[model samples]
Target: MNKKQILTGFLAVTIFAACQQGTANQDKAKDGKSISAGAKVPAAPDAAILTFEKESYDFGKIKQGEKVHYDFKFRNTGKTPLIISNATATCGCTIPEIPKAPVKPGDEGIIKVVFNSTGKMGIQDKVITVTSNANPEINEVHLKGEVTEP
Candidate 1:
């Protein structure tokens, strides 16, 4: 083959291989085939899957200076244990608590959020971000309500 023809063929093969590289690290499909890159795949059997029963919470109308709290329930639906590494809030008025222990598969847990309406008034929306080893990595929950004077 001519050098020019061989170079073109090599370049084409290289491009094709490069395009196929990212999919190798992707998860498998239900049919036990590897899913293509950028395609959604089911959670790995050995990976943790976090499932939230409620992603948002509404505290209704709460009086200023009152402390409101809710338990955001979740379950580990994957085959592996779920570990919540961190839980944070958007502001100091809100606090979130996550368990230190790993949540085994099929086990349930709660993310406790305490909202302090001390200086807050009117319509308020606060967010709590939970980081875990579960599929998708991070999850968000909300606390919303109107704060009125007592």
Candidate 2:
């Protein structure tokens, strides 16, 4: 094999060996309690989760320069309160408004997305991404429609 390929193979083997050694060390504890080899680590409690009622909205058709909005409803289905760090859109024409307060577990929240069709035409799709402390921390909502000439 070429020198570069040989080097790559050696690097891969070295990384694999290192990872195996790390896993083997996880079976032992300094306090004399031995963890079972097959034991799995438990996940953290009360991770936030977002359950959306609907992820997309279709406005059908609208004239150019018209503005429309939709509220994306969601619930905090996990054990903890949902805190949204930020919500942003794919473009300036689409603005997203997220909740300022934390959504408690089992409580609902809304993410409002307003889309402006100014200077836009044809089939348009706008996306708003929500970032929060929720598990799988990022979620997206979409607004799509046809913008007809005025």
Candidate 3:
């Protein structure tokens, strides 16, 4: 073959090889794999962490001498089991009920709050303290609303 022809053949072969290499790299990237690029991945959070979906409750408007109840649902988003030690209301007029057992990861639980507005008038605010194994350890949930006079 002429020198010009040989050089043209070499260039075509090199281009083909480069194209094949690029296709292989794309396939590796498409395999749904990930790498940290020499960095360590963060450890999963503890399983026993109690995380509430909401931080507060609004009771809206209620008449005096009435009663209301609300349930706050939560999920165990950590990697360990979650345990709620206790739940306390801000005042005697408000009652809170917390889960009694540990909640496994991806599981759900509830916290129930009952408010008695017998003697309360106008707006009322209450809080429920939740003690758990969550990162912050202690969480305070709040309840607020207006109690209109009957």
Candidate 4:
């Protein structure tokens, strides 16, 4: 073939190769394969529901240097299991514990919070954020109490 024809043929082959590569990449994505670049993969079946009996708790009042406990009950209102991934307190003095097992639909669970008033005084407001598979994915629970001087 002439030089022009040769160049045109090479161009066609290059374009074809690029198109094939793109199709392959799309196929990989469809097959749940990660590309070379590190990107966040979406979780499978991305919807859930969680219902809480009470979002906030009032401890009323407690003496300084004392520890108090509270339980925040919730229900799995969604079709799938409710998995609480983690729970975090607003301050070090406040600790929270959550169930690791999945709560089935229509089942009940509890998030227990403990507030330590050691060295802490006056009115206090704390928060615990619970992360889960529930739709909206995060739940906030509040605690408030007045700490009397020991």
Candidate 5:
């Protein structure tokens, strides 16, 4: 076949294959059952809810190199158990401890956070983010204070 004829044939085959592939995919999509990106799934009737009595604490002024701690009190107000999956602090100088076991419904819990002023100076604000099986899934607590020279 001449170069022009061969090129035309190749182009025709490529277009035909692409057209077939497109139709096949479209048909499969129409026949298959799948969840849409924005589809709303059935929510839990008895979900875990985390309610905090206090979300922020002020440790006030502390000497540099001193350590201060606070306990953030919370309760599980929902019907299901509250399981904390993770707790993280914005700075390494701050450490947060979560409940190792699940907090049952109507039961109270505490998240203890310790802030070390060793290397931190001046106005300090440490944030702790907690993730759990609670309805909201995520919660935050703050620790504020000032570190002065020792």
Candidate 6:
């Protein structure tokens, strides 16, 4: 190839490599949290942890059309405050209530789950998914029971 052509290709390759290097450097800060373009990134957490007393509950046998409720207790076992962002249930028959306020470090909280057996029968298993600022980010609690015809 001609000298000009070779020199041009070399310059192009150099520019491309430099651009890639800059992009990779900006992808994350020194602490490893990703940095977004023109948007504020969330700060690294200080080890907010959530610990549950029990991950599952059994209501045993209940009559159809009856409702059952249980409280899933938890504690913030880390150095930072624990904030529950949301709580979701597997089905409409199960409803979960998560505290709106943050649970401070070493503090305790409760998540209440109510299962409606109005039209349900036989063995029923429901799940509640809790989202928080904890390390794992999500947690699951289960509710199981047998509903007999009234």
Best by TM-score: 5
Pairs clashing within candidate 2 = none
lDDT of 2 by residue, 1-150 (tens): 999999999999999998988777657645567776766434347788998998889999999999998999999999988999999998999999899999999999999888999999999989888998888778888899999999
Off by over 4 Å in 5: 1-43
lDDT, candidates in the order shown: 0.90, 0.89, 0.82, 0.86, 0.88, 0.89
Q: Rank the candidates by lDDT, best first.
A: 1, 6, 2, 5, 4, 3
- Expressed as tens digits, the lDDT of each residue in 8-108 for candidate 1 is 99999999897787655677778988776577665565899889999888889989999998999999998899999999999999999999899999999
Residue range 102-149, candidate 6, lDDT tens digits: 999999999999999999989998989998888778889899999999
TM-score of each: 0.70, 0.71, 0.67, 0.70, 0.73, 0.72
Residue runs of model 1 more than 4 Å from their true location after superposition: 1-45
- What residue pairs are clashing in model 5? none
lDDT of 3 by residue, 1-150 (tens): 999999999999999998887655532223356543443333345536667788888989999988989898898888888889889987899999888888888999999999999999988889899887776677788889999988
Worst window of 10 by summed lDDT in candidate 4 = 35-44
lDDT (10s digit) by residue, model 4, range 14-71: 9999988766664335577756434434555635577889998888888999998999
lDDT preference between candidates 1 and 2, better one? 1
- True-structure lDDT of candidate 4: 0.86
Q: Rank the candidates by TM-score, best first.
A: 5, 6, 2, 1, 4, 3
Alpha-carbon deviation at 4 in model 6, angstroms: 34
- Put down candidate 5 lDDT per residue, 61-91, tens digits, no spaces: 9999999988999999999999999999998
